[model samples]
Target: MTTPADVHGVREPGLPGRLLTVERDALVPLLRGRAEEDFTLPVAACPGWSVRDVLAHCSSAFTRVLEGRFEQGVFSPACNDRDIAERAEWSNQRVVDELERGMTEAGPVIAKAGGVLDILALGEWVHAGDVREAFGEPGAYAGAGLPSALSLMAYVTCRKGHLSLHADLDDADEPLRLGDISGRRPPARYIGDGPTLVRLYAGRPVDGASYELAGAEAGELNIFDE
Candidate 1:
């Protein structure tokens, strides 16, 4: 099993705490001052989900993590959908308040989840991006959470397959690689900004022109979309 330290290359203590701090700071401010109509806006990254739905899902996830109620699977889109649906009647401000309270209470539990913190942080960052994009606001993708998000992407790719590939991101300090260890090298590689790379890994769309690919086959890398 990969530990949080192993998954994120954590060289210092309190990395999880720092990440939670970043998530809180980035998300809470975005929720403030949002109008009722704003909650109905569609989040491009999460098709069929309104901005309010995204908040409900995020808030539920944080609460679940705190309560030790995670689903049993690699990904749980169904459970996510259920989470949002159950909170359908919640006012936008109520959902935001729940999210804030859950995150505040989840810090210690999340920090103790071994390597799972990466995935948790990734989800928060991605949904935060969704919320920001829906509001026509710029995201804080370049913040303290970027490195951990990148690491989680690499880990997810590795788990999905063993096709060798490399990633070059404008904001990343070092290039990321996967499937190189199995002696099966594929020619195609990804080149783009860190946020775009993370979005792609999370099965979110990136404008085709925003990134470039080189090498064997692009379809081989789509496993993360599943």
Candidate 2:
């Protein structure tokens, strides 16, 4: 049965693009407002990556999509590192400029790929949260685009054939079901807010997150780290 959240529902062709556009409205302005030194802050969610590096990687990834540059292992760590390295000499403004452009333009390209690249938009939004948290901002991982991101996440997790889990989030109107939806595996359980659920799936540090789980380890929820 397809719930309003899209569990067992059809893939939304415009959802990824909409997510990107929504995130850009929120994130690009925030990035543009920060001082030069703020970009140097390390994102704990992505160790060894400064805010600048995250932005660089995001823009470059979008550029790849726009330019149709998907080679083998395109988004591997090595490829991401190479992308960041290519931007090392660019000014901070230049990087942000490219990021703004990417966020604005990558949607159509992603939409054209059908569902193959939908996860990229969700990942980009989460990285935006990582940046927000590094800046000590409240509501780091939750925002206007969260509902859409969560919907997309459920689809991605289910498609990945991971463990099934049912999330009872305090902040959401209804439970979010993720991972293998086939009846062969009973869904695991999670009780928490939406952002913490995102933390689990993204493999971000969640030491202080207040959440409950049964039938599946927290690590098993990770889609990004896989």
For this target, which candidate reaches the highest TM-score against the unseen true structure? 2
| TM-score versus the correct structure, for each prediction | 0.78, 0.95
What clash pairs does model 1 have?
4-114, 4-115, 187-215, 187-216, 188-214, 188-215, 188-216
The per-residue C-alpha lDDT of model 1 at residue 177 equals 71
Instruction: Say which candidate scores most in lDDT.
Output: 2
Query: What lDDT tens digits, residue by residue, belong to model 2 across residues 98-151?
Result: 988888999888888878898898899999999999999898888888888889
Write down the worst ten-residue block by lDDT for model 2.
1-10
Q: Write the per-residue lDDT of candidate 1 for residues 1-226, one digit (tens) a residue.
A: 1113334223232454565667777778768777789989998878898989888988888888777886585138888888888898888888999888876677677657665554565567677877887888864355556776566556545544546667776666667775434556643588877776666555666665378877754455544355
lDDT of 1 at 73: 55
Q: What is the TM-score of candidate 1?
A: 0.78
lDDT to native, each model: 0.67, 0.87
